[model samples]
Target chain A: MDIKNMQEAELKAAIKKVMQDNFGLSDIADDADFIKDLKIDSITRMELLLKLEDEFGVRVEDNDAQNMLSVDATAQLLKKIAG
Target chain B: MASKIVVTGLGWSTPFGCDLDQAFDALFNGKTATFRTQNINLDGLYCQVSAQIPRNEAIFPFEKWQKELPGNKASMFTIFGLEAAERALLDAKLIDQEGGYVDQNLKIGVVVGSGIGGLEDHFNTSQVILEKGANRVSAFYVPAALINLLPGHIAIRHKIKGPNQSQVAACSTGAIAIADGARMIVEGRCDIMVVGAGEASIGRLGIAGFCALRALASGYNDNPQQASRPFDKKRSGFVMGEGAGILILESEESAKRRGAKIYCEYLGAGLSNDAYHMTSPCADGAGAIAAISDALYWSKKTPNQVQYINAHATSTGLGDAAEMSAIKFIFGDCIEKNSFAVSSIKGAIGHMLGAAGSVEAVATILSLHKQKLLPTINLEEPDEFAYHNDKLINLVPNNGIEASLDCVMSTSFGFGGHNVALVFGRY
Candidate 1:
């Protein structure tokens, strides 16, 4: 699941699924920072990291949590973690 | 320092029964409603045993106000507390006889305590992340799971307008709820207050979490009654129980003016902390002593004046001994004698945690009226800490028999090192 390597359409769907699943938000705005805009508290973000690993079948390095700012940034980080 | 307060009404939802009188009767006759769980799937767990109340005991039917509350611990507790409060207010005769307990004239308040608020809510919501995704989560999840909302829901439904708050200190929550309501009465903040604690954490996450900490007993899966032995030598760990115990506290002046039936006087309360560990107490028992000593001080009575102590003895490895040492500190030279009637119903009800304090307070008040010591069952052999188990009961063979009761005290120590004690006596 290298989110960056995936085609544009597939990546959008995957990000959509991840945001919808992890955050429980019916709507995910494109410019949304997964942390700030969603109001996902620190614990939830850590939980998000765990979910990412569980869903993507990858190991999210500790440093990757902070770099996971925007939903787009999260999609890119999945590429790194997946590698 | 403050005006006198009286217990005008009482309510409880327990494994024994729904109403307070029924529960008390079942409790007195030594009937424990605990049974082995054949329902929920709890495979990888430390304690397969639980003291679950019958499902039918739910105060309100489905599609009631709880439908608006959502599926969570708060949803369950809100419903339970509402039923308890409804019964309590009605019993106090504050409401209309034709309708029920609802009086617009009453200046009422509510204090509902929760040990761990809505653990089930969070656990179920977390699953939405795995299954339906984030958007599938309930919008009302945050409000439904918040610990403070127990009182919030109660106040919203009943329109209680005085002091409203939630007390949380793990297991000691219920005891603090009563004391806080007492303070409100003494301060003249409200004429009447409905107070109690509730928890509904009996799920896969709850059992798994406790198992993770190794804090639940795994010994008596075959027989649930024998599972929780508080002061016994072979006592392993506490059995988790859930429910709510509510008491209506009113000023003596108010109760006297209204001619309400009185249960007992809410004398004094004490609170302290071990400040030692996150979950464990300091073996020296400094916090426990401070709480008991202060409660005695508030009552303006000597330890000798006390006749019974409904101890917060959870029957854990260190907790039971810590409580004994604290009692020794308060009773001093008196504890060695047949000093006071003392027992932990945790052996019977498995430890009610959040509701333990209020439920045990009800038990202590019953002792004052009935004048008999409640037994700590499941004790085959007493441990080093409690050799006086048999001697704990003074008025013999007359369980629930009325006798002279000067004063009694109840104690609760919770997580984050929170400690509280309440003293009561006849009006």
Candidate 2:
């Protein structure tokens, strides 16, 4: 739950696990866009954001949810939130 | 001459396990899969017993299925349909080693049916709207809840590009789907059709809705296993059940060319309406008789040819008696003399509603393939109303009976007097 202390690699690994474990996407890339590459529709995006928030114990602003569409972007956002 | 349509494969994700042999064996043994559920507060609802798919626990774990379709926000009925479709296609060898299409140009079609689409999801979304803000509602709610999306998701997943449709006729939905799909092959509309029905409406709303109608068994809450006693003198009402049944139907020519393993021939379907009442069937069984007669007529077979019947007796008093009367009218005094065997699988699996017809159709086909009649369990004393001439119609009570069956009929009548009967013959 203390995602603020998670390293960049750990954050990325967690994100990858969420994609594979939660969404059942095994072929996701480090920079794969949720919408474009993974076919995550609008509803799924909301679900993914909620899941990320739950996993990281971080509050994702509505505006930031739109920007955090890729794993890399999500990791960056997590780092920003932690800072 | 009407083209012959044969079933090449069948799949079901039932409260009973999916293994055909095992499921049939359990049904033969009169094993009850229903149990008391805490999913819905029994204090608020009358019926406490339901045949629910065991989820994320011992027995049949749903976690593996969850992994297969991760983040699947679709309704559970759609998920069940997709899973059954996958199994059926695999059984038919329609998929290649790489899990791709065996023949991309096979002109396959899909017809799936459901009684109430996403009632659970609809209830949840409404709760979210009431408890949380309106903005908290998810976008997938509508797509997951819509009925037609059952086939739409299937076609998209399996790349089936021929005729696509979904049916809704309450409990008769499954049989109508199978009939309509078989017609597609007979009419040269498609060479192969994936047909069946899935239902997952055992949630609060689903149970409460039926409870309000006083259509569910309420007295056997303590003994859940005995809740669904179809065709029995003590039978009170039907027990709610949920699952899916999908069959791979192919033109006889196509099946022969592919060397497909044929299970049984889907001769034809007969459809009729009672025009009597919204919920109750015609007391004289006219609609049921006409439907069965029509099915026999469409199949060009005589009543004497039907060696077995998988009845749609939902354990309700009048419903069982009416169906028995219809069969007597069709088969005459021979029925009471055990000329042919008859049974209802509801005693084991309960009433599957929209999926009942297709599920029982699968049971009928399996009976044909295995040459064994499934027992109508819990029929301790066959209802007097189902008896004719001081004899109970060969209801195949208590234990399964082995018999050679050349042709069998499965009947399904829904809430709106929707009567459907389908005849299947040995391939």
Candidate 3:
């Protein structure tokens, strides 16, 4: 739960696990765009946001959710939230 | 002259597996797929048995379609529908080996239906709203639960541009889907139509609801294989099963032009409503008789010419007898002389709800093609109605029989007394 204290590799792994388990995506690159590369449409994007909220126990605002589109961006947002 | 309709391909995702030959062989061998329900808690439910597709079966080619369409948004019925539709199109040779359309300009449409379209998904979403909150519900719930989305997804995947529709006649949905597809071609709406039904309602609520109606077999929970004994003396009620069946129906000229392998000709389809009861058939079987008679009349064939019948005998006390009464009324001398065989594949695969008629349609078409009769398993002792004047009707009990089958009819009746009879003949 301590995203601020978590290592970069651990945060990235957590994000990847959620994407793989929920979206059936595996080996997603950290910089791969969710919409462009993963083809995560609007519905799937909303689902990913809810899943992340449930996983991290944080309230993701609309603007924050938009920025948390990739593994790297999501990790950055989670660290900022934990702070 | 009306356009001649023909079935060029058939596919099904059945409890016996998806391969057409393998599933048909299992049915012919009288193999039962009903088993004790493994996924749901049966402590409070009256029925404990269901026939579900094996968990390991790769029902959806996830990797193949994920690029074009995300698999996470689809419901179980859509998943089965897509798999069956893909197999059917491939079988029709309309799709090349790489899953691309062979003739991209062909006018194709889709009509796929389901009895309880995504009840499992709706149930899950309801729980999510109750436990987590309404805001937690997934945005994909609506599309996933709509019945029309089955055909919608099919059309999107195949790029079919003609009329796209879905029928929701409960148990008769499958037969009516095929019938409507043929009508579309006959009316020059489309040259080809993908027609069929799918169902996946074996969830907790599905079982409890059917149990409340006492419409499911409960006595044979310990012996699941014998639970669905259609026309048998010990039959209690129907067993719930989940799967999908699809067929490629094309205009005769279109099929010949494409040089496709024709399975059978769609002779006629008769639709009628009992207007009798909510969940029960009329004791006189008038509605069923009308449907069968209409089908025969339109096909220009007499009862004597129909060598086999795939009945909608769901193993209920009143349903089986009602069907027999109707058959006697329509096929009068044929039943007494044992000239035609009647069998219900529900004995082997249980009742597939909306998918039953189309699955049985596939079986009937195959029977005409192979000149073989499928068997009704678990019919250890025939019910009294299966006989008249000490001569028993050929129920094709326990084992498959070889026969010269040219014309065959498949009948389906739903809870609302909707009846549809489809007649097919060898091409």
- Which regions in candidate 1 have their CA more than 4 angstroms from the true location? A1-83, B57-74, B97-101, B336-339, B388-403
Interface RMSD of 2: 2.6
Predicted candidate 3 versus true structure: per-residue lDDT over B130-189, tens digit per residue: 999998888788888899999998877777778899999989999999999988898887
Specify the highest-TM-score model's number: 3
Evaluate model 3: give its lDDT.
Answer: 0.87
Q: Worst ten-residue run, lDDT, model 2 chain B?
A: B96-105
What lDDT score goes with residue B70 in model 2?
59
Please name the candidate that would achieve the greatest DockQ relative to the true structure. 3
Model 2, TM vs. native: 0.91
Error of 3 at A81 (Å): 2.8
True contacts kept of 3: 0.44
Better of 1 and 3 by lDDT: 3
Report the number of backbone clashes for model 2: 0
Question: On TM-score, who's better, 1 or 2?
Answer: 2
TM-scores of chain A across candidates: 0.76, 0.89, 0.92
Best-first order by DockQ: 3, 2, 1
Q: Cα lDDT for residue B184, model 1? A: 82
- Candidate 2 residue-wise lDDT, B162-212, digit = tens: 889999999999999999998888788889999999999998888999999
**Which segments of model 2 are wrong by more than 4 Å?**
A1-21, A25-32, A35-43, A50-65, A75-83, B56-61, B96-102
lDDT of 1 by residue, B266-338 (tens): 9989988887898888787888999998898888989999977888878688888888778866775555576
